[model samples]
Target: MRRVLLIQKAADKKDAKPEEIKKSFRTMGVTACQQMQGKKASDVEFLVSSKVGSSELLGIFENSFHLTNYENSHKKQPSEEEQEKDKEEEALDKDDRTKRINKKVDNFVVSTENTSVVEDQDYKFQQASARATEFARNLANARGSVATPEWMEHQIMDLLKKHEGKVGEVRVLQADELQKLGMNLFYNVGKGAISQPRCVIVHYEGNPEKKGEVEIALVGKGVTFDTGGLNLKPSGYMEDMYGDKGGSCAVLGALQ
Candidate 1:
């Protein structure tokens, strides 16, 4: 026997037409002859076991109800003249900014020979530290996690490898393990969503040979998505929650 499940949100219940629902189910290759209603926001899972593979069923669900004509209907084609004008304006703006920056640089003066060796060394150290901090911040705020998806992990690892000397080694901890390790404070704030919270520990041992040297440990809070959890937040308050992982991004930027 084939089964079909229709899970609709309370907000969508009134607006969802029967034909649309049926069409969505049918598109998933499931015969929507019956449906069992459930509480709001929960997935309406269907136990479909047939000759059709689960992958196919999943594909149907994924593609079903996608706005087919909306993009085409809403798309506005720019005229050739409009496109040319935009390009010209962008080029002029870029030229103006470059000229302004060059003029500023020309006014800037540096007295390298007059400065003491200690001052020069301290300046270099400060610059290196700032670079590390920026790299760390950028990684923390970077979109997505290297834990859930292998492909993404590979990509991130490759990126880290590119900055091998600066980053050293990148370690991605499992969500459950990270929680057990008492890093839940950062992870728990953005739980209960499709995107899994991850704790990425980026190691940067710039000078490892010296014994008893204090290595700088820069940590950043990475929240993939902040829904304000059980506390609940006003719509406006939650608008900028996407940037909650900015601390981590800052760490990434510093490291870079």
Candidate 2:
């Protein structure tokens, strides 16, 4: 299920009065606006037609409200120092929440339509293990500077060793080795300023009957953080740079 914003546009092209906005929404077939009227909160959630895209809805709100008063009514602005502290605290809180969720184990089946993998194969255990492992990695990755390229390599290699009996063979290529072999895929940005990128491959043969047959190969991008590379990201955009390694962690989870 998806949540969306419902916006009401006033007919008069002037400062919005409460009654005018209600009438406009009622005309537009959004009855909830009248019911939710005069509610005040830092965050607001309301139902809207799936057809109404966020851009259009936000545009309507932008046009109807008195900009300064509307923004100030909800909350006051936080100082830069407060904002940074809040961001760090939020990341730590998320880490704790994920850890708690990972401890709970339950069996569930995923139903898919028109998928390449057979629907009846029933890899539920594998999927559960993968998801838990992924959450752990994601939490670790959320910590700033802890999910570097070298750190990612160590994590992946550790997972390979932890599941040694289940996995067939694991191979790792160090940064210098990768560079010498002309595989400079991840170092285009930050070049020698940061840790050299590394790659790890895990070959798992859960079934000995099909030893020589290969069904699928999955490649995961392991750029631990994207500082927009050499270009660099402006203020607001750089906060979530650590999420760039998501694909690699996902691959690591599946392999584990």
Candidate 3:
């Protein structure tokens, strides 16, 4: 059997010593771990065995998922200080009860073998959720002209129509149509491009009682990949330009 040992990055364990890590390998049942004499702790790589909690492991999975590269990422990895700052983000997200519930759900979904929960709808909806995430990920990661305003329009319409009963009033407006209504800024942005510009509108009648009244309007920008309009970016700086569509892609996924 092949064994895979996960070594925490040197940035995460800044205080670990090289010799100490090598010695700890013996207790971790990784006796074959090799160490070079001149290597620093940061350069040394070895698994530091620990019993990771469910929530902690889930956090690691989320971090890995978000860091996945679509175009063999040209950007440098986050620095130690940057990682710490991410950890320090505002905590007004939820209360303790919600966290406890999340931990329990995460643990159950990952490790439980309870067959009763394996119903048909569970499999179906889980697959749908997976597809939504994948769609959003791909759309946000698409580079170059692979995804454009008109292309995004088609995609949105296809998705909305796929679930026809749920979402209604789907339409695509051309550049001239948008300009007629005084959306010159949006119209001008895509008029020069060969693929042209399009505005996609989707409606969901969640509340039938208030049919005509609007409650929430979600906006997403499908920026032309890397071709910054008037102010162009350097070639190197334009990497992952498709990531600018993240906001809209997220809205699409949530709708899905």
Cα TM-score per model: 0.40, 0.46, 0.51
Model 1 bad stretches (over 4 Å): 1-159, 165-170, 182-188, 226-232
Write the number of the candidate with greater TM-score, choosing between 1 and 3: 3
lDDT of each: 0.44, 0.50, 0.53
Decide which is better by TM-score, 1 or 2.
2
Of the two candidates 2 and 3, the one with more favorable lDDT, higher being better, is 3
Candidate ranking under TM-score, highest first, comes to: 3, 2, 1
| Native RMSD of candidate 2 (Å) | 14.9
What tens digits encode model 3's per-residue C-alpha lDDT throughout 31-125? 11211111111122222223432233323322222222122333467678865654554254333322211111111122223333324353345
Evaluate residue 12 in candidate 1 and report its C-alpha lDDT on the 0 to 100 scale: 27
What's the CA RMSD for each of the models? 28.0, 14.9, 15.7
CA displacement after TM-score superposition, residue 78 of candidate 3 (Å): 14
CA lDDT of 236 in candidate 2?
72
Worst 10 residues of 1 by lDDT: 100-109
Instruction: Compose the digit string of candidate 1's lDDT tens values, residues 1-256.
Output: 4333444422326688756654554444322211211111112333333332223223333223121101122235667886777578658665432221111111111122333422444435544553455344434434443322333345356657767666555677767887889977655654664555555666676565753477777766545443335444577855445456666556555645
Best by lDDT: 3
The residue-by-residue lDDT of candidate 2 on 27-143, one tens digit each, is 443233322222211233433334433332323332222121121123346678866875786586653323211121121121233232222223333334434554545543564
